[model samples]
Target: MKEALKSFFGLDDESDDDELLSKNLNDDIAIDPDFVMSTDMLLAAIMEAYRVMDRDKDALDLFLTKYEHMHENESLRLMSEKKKKDPSLSSMHSSKEEDKQRLVQSANEALRTFFKMNNDEDARLLFRSLNDSSRTAETYIIMVGGLVEKEPWSGEISQLYQSAVQSKCLTEELAFLAMKSVVFSKLDGKMRVLRDIIADTSSVLNISPEEFNSSRYWQLKRTLGYRFAKLLMWWRNLSSSWEKELKLSVRQLKQGRQGGHVIDEDALRCIVKFAGHNQRDDINQGVPVSDGPSEKDQVIQNKERKYGIKLIREVVVDAHQTTLYNSPAFVDDVAIGFCSLKAYDECIKFVKEMHSRDLIKLKQSTYEHAIYAAEEKKDLKMVDELIRNMEDGCSLNIK
Candidate 1:
C-alpha cells in the first residue's frame, strides 16, 4: 500500500504521508471526498502531490472541475431517468423550488471556481449556462464583486461589464449590480453601457433624466448635448464660407410661417443656446405670443428673413398654447385657467391646428391628457377628432 501510494503521488517512500496531508489540507475542508475525489487513494495521492509541488491552485482547480462535471452528469442522468419514468416528472422536477434553488447554487459554485482560477473565458461560458434569473443574478453579483475587488477602479473590470451587456442574457438586476460595482471606476466604456441601458426604449422610461444625472451616466449626458450640437457647429466654426450660407438657411427658415409651429422648450433652448450671443439680454426671453399677431410676430419675421428660421424663444405663452405644446411650465396653468374658464372652442381650435401641423406629438400620456381635457370641456366632437388624429398619426409614424 505504501509503495503504491508513493508511486501514485510521485513521492519518495521516506516522505511522510501524514505530514504532507496536513500541509495539503485547505483552510476549509468542507468539500465531500466522494464529490471532490473519485476514490480515497486518489484523493490522498492528489493531496500529496499538491503538497509536494506547493500547487494549491492546481489541486483546487482539478478538484472543482471533476466535482462540477460529476454533478452535471448526475443531474442529466437524474433528469433522463425521471423523464423515462414519467414525462411530466421532468416538468415537475424543473418546477420544484428546491431543485431550482439547487441548480442556482451549483451554478454559483461553478462560477466561483471559474473566477478563482482567473479563467475569464470559461467563467463567461459558465455564466452563459446559468439561464435562471436567480442563478444569473448570483453569478453576476459574485463576478462583479470579485472583479471590483481584484481590479478596483480599473479598465479590466470594465471589460467584464461590456461582456455582460453583450451577453444578451443579463437581467436588469445583474446589469445594475455590474454598473454599481464599477461606479467608482470611472470607466468610459462602462458608463456608455449604463447610458445605453438606461436609454433603451424597449424598457419603460422609469430612469428619469435626474436619476441619470446622479449616476456615472451624468458625464455622458453632459457630453451628449454638446456632441449633438457639434455636428452643426463644426462646419460653421471651421469654415468661414459655410457660415454665411448656414446663416442664410437659418434666416429663411425663421421668417417662414413654419417657424410658429413645432416650438418646444428643448428645441427652443437648443436653437438659442447654440446661436451664441454676447449678452443674456440678446436672447428674447418671454412667453411666445400665440394670440392675434403682435410686434413679436414682425420681430420673428425679420429674424427669419435675416437668419432664415424663427429662433427659439424663452417667453411664456398663454395657457392655451402651453397645454397644446405640453410645456410643463404651462401645463398646470393651462389646466386650472383654461378648463375652468370653459374656453372649449379656443382649446379645440388649438388642438385641430396643432394636430394638422404635426406640432403636437402625442405620447401615450399626452393622448390621455388631451382626451381628459376634451371630456371635461364636454366637446365630444373635439375629443373624437383628437383621438382619431392621434391614432392615425401614431400608426403612420409606426409604419
Candidate 2:
C-alpha cells in the first residue's frame, strides 16, 4: 500500500516514514490544499479563529506566539507598537475635555487668520466652531475692529453689522465703535440697527441723562440725530409720520447757532418744498398761506424786476422769425411780468441768450406766458428776428 501511495503522490524514493507522516499531518489541517500557504495567511487564520470563538485570551496567546518571529521586521515592529498604544485595543477612552480644548485653540488660530485676510467664509467657519461664548465674543471683536479699520467689503458691511447684533457678542465699546463705523460707511441698515440698539440700551439699562450726555455717548447721539435728519431730508417721499419724526429728531439735535452738522441744503430745500406743496390746510391748523410779496413771492418779484422786461422783447422777436422758436419758463416768467410795460428788442435779446444756454425749460405755463407776452408787444419785426436767432442757435424742436 505504501509503495502504491508513493507512486501516486510522486514522493522521493529515499523519504523516511517520519517525513511521510509529517506531510500527511499538514495536509489534514490545510485550509486550501490546492493553494500554497504563507506565514501571513497562517497568522490570519489563527487570529480569525480566535475572533470567531470569542477567545480574547486565545487571540493574545496566538499573537504572542508569532510576534517574536515577526518583530524583527521594522514595519511589523512599528505596527505592533502602534497596536499597543491604541486606546480602543487597550480598553481605554481618551480625555474628551482635552480634545475639546485643543479644538478650540485650533479654531481661534483659524479665526486670527480669517481676520487678517477678511475671508468671510473662513471667518464664518471659525465663528461656527467656537464653543466658548467669551472666545466667540473676542473673535468677533477682532473681526469687527479689522473691518472698521480696513473698510473691506463695504457692500457687505451691513450684513456683518446685522450678524454682530444678532450674536450679541460685542462689548459696549465694541458696539459703539461699530456704530461709529457704520455712520462713516453711510449704510442705512447698520444705522437703523444702531438706533434700535441705542434706544433699547437706554430703556433697559436705565442709563442716566448724564451718561447719555457724556462726550462719547453724546458724540454717538449727535451722529444719530444728524443722520436721522439727513435721512428725513433725502428720503422725503416717505410717510408723513416718518417726516414728522425726522423733523422732531432734527429739532432735538444739538445744533449750533448756524446749523447742526453739515446739512445738505439741496436735500433740505427739496424736503421743505415737497412738504409745503402737499400740505393739507383742512387737516392742519394755521398752515402759513403763501400770499403775494411773501418770501417766495419776493424771489419771483426780484427775478421779474431784474430780467422780466428784457426777456419779453427777445421772445416777441423770436416768435415772429420762426415757427419753431420757443422760450423757456424763466424767460417766459420774466416776459409775462413786463412784456406790456417794456420794449420788444431787449426781451428778444435776453431770450436768445437764455436759449443758447438751454436753462429756460422751467414749465409749460411759463412758456405759454412768454408767447402771450410776444403777442401783446406788437413788435413783429423784433419777434421775427428773435425767432430767426433761436432757430439758428437752438434745436428746432424747442418748445
Candidate 3:
C-alpha cells in the first residue's frame, strides 16, 4: 500500500517510502495488516487521482458520497482529532447543511472544470443537478454563451435559460444572451423562443426596479423588439392575413411600451417597412391566389401603413424628448416611412429636429427627403440651403 501510494504520488526513491507512510497515517498507528487507510484518506487519494486524470465528474461523485457517509466513520475520526486538542471541541462537528454546501461547491468546481475542457454535455448535466445556492448569473452566461454557437443545442439552451430564470439567476447579461441566441438559431419556431425570452426577461425585471431601469435592460428590450419585428416580417407567408400581422406588430409594440421599454429606431423601422411594403404580389407571384385584395382589405392595408407611420412619428418625438434617441440610420428609415406616406413636410421637420439636437451629418436619404420636401414647396432657396448642408456632410464623409 505504501509502495502504491508512492507510485500514485510519483515518488520513486526508497527513501520516500517512510515519508509517504508517515504522510498518510497518524503517528500513533502501529504497522499492521488491520491498520488500513481511513475512509477519508482513501477517498481523498482517489479524488486526487480522478482530478489528475481530468475525471471531474467522477471526483464530484466520490466527494458527495463522502458526505453521505461522513456521519459514521468520518465523524468519529474528526471527533478523535478534536478531543486530542481540546475536549470541548469534540462535541462540535460539521452540520449536514455545511456538508451539503461543500458538496455543492465541489460540484460547481467540477462544472467549471468541464466548461474549461469544452465538454459542454458534461457541464450541462452537472449544471442541471446543481443547487441554485452560490450560483451566479455569470455562471449561466458562461455556459449558455458557449452553447449558443452549437446550433443543434438550441432547445437545450432555451431550457437552460428557463431554468436559470426560474432559479432567479438570470440577469440582464444572461437575458440578452438568451434572446440573441434564440434569434440567431436555425431552428424553426425561433419566434416562439424569442417571445418566451421576452416574457421571461420582463418577468424577471419586474421584481427589481433598479435593474428594470438599467442600461443593460434597455438594450435587451430594444434587441428583443427589433429581432421579433424582423422575424415577424420574415413570417409574412405564415400569417393568415395582413391585418393579423399588422395587429400582432402593433400589439408587440404596445407591450414593449407598456413594459417601460423604449421602442428604439431599429424596431420602429422594421415595423414601418413591413407595414408599407405590399406582399400581395409576392404572395401570388408563383402561386394560385386572388387577383387582388378586396376593398375592405385595401382599407385595412391603408390603416396598417398610416398607423405604423403614426407610431414611428410618436416614438421619434418621445425619443427626442427623452434625449435617448440617436441613430443616423434610424433617421433615414423614418424619412423613408414618411416619404411613403407622402408626409414630406413631416419628414423634413423630423430631420431638422435631429439636426437641431446636434445629430448632424445625417444620411443621404434624410437629406433627399428634406430636399424633396423643399422642392414640393417650390422653395429653391430652401433646396439650395439643404444642398449646401448635404455637401458639407459629404466633404466630411458623414454618410
- Candidates in order have lDDT scores of 0.45, 0.42, 0.56
| Model 2 lDDT per residue over 319-376, tens place | 3343223434324444333433332334344454565666344333333333444655
Mind giving the per-residue lDDT tens digits that candidate 1 earns over 234-314? 334534523333343344335433556433333332333323222122222311223226887666544532331223222
lDDT of 1 at 78: 76
**Model 2 TM-score on a 0 to 1 scale:** 0.28
Better of 1 and 3 by TM-score: 3
Candidate maximizing lDDT: 3
Steric clashes per prediction: 19, 15, 0
Q: What are the TM-scores, per candidate, against the unseen true structure? A: 0.29, 0.28, 0.50
Candidate 1's C-alpha lDDT? 0.45
Judged by whole-model lDDT over C-alpha atoms, candidate 3 comes out at: 0.56
lDDT of 2 at 115: 52
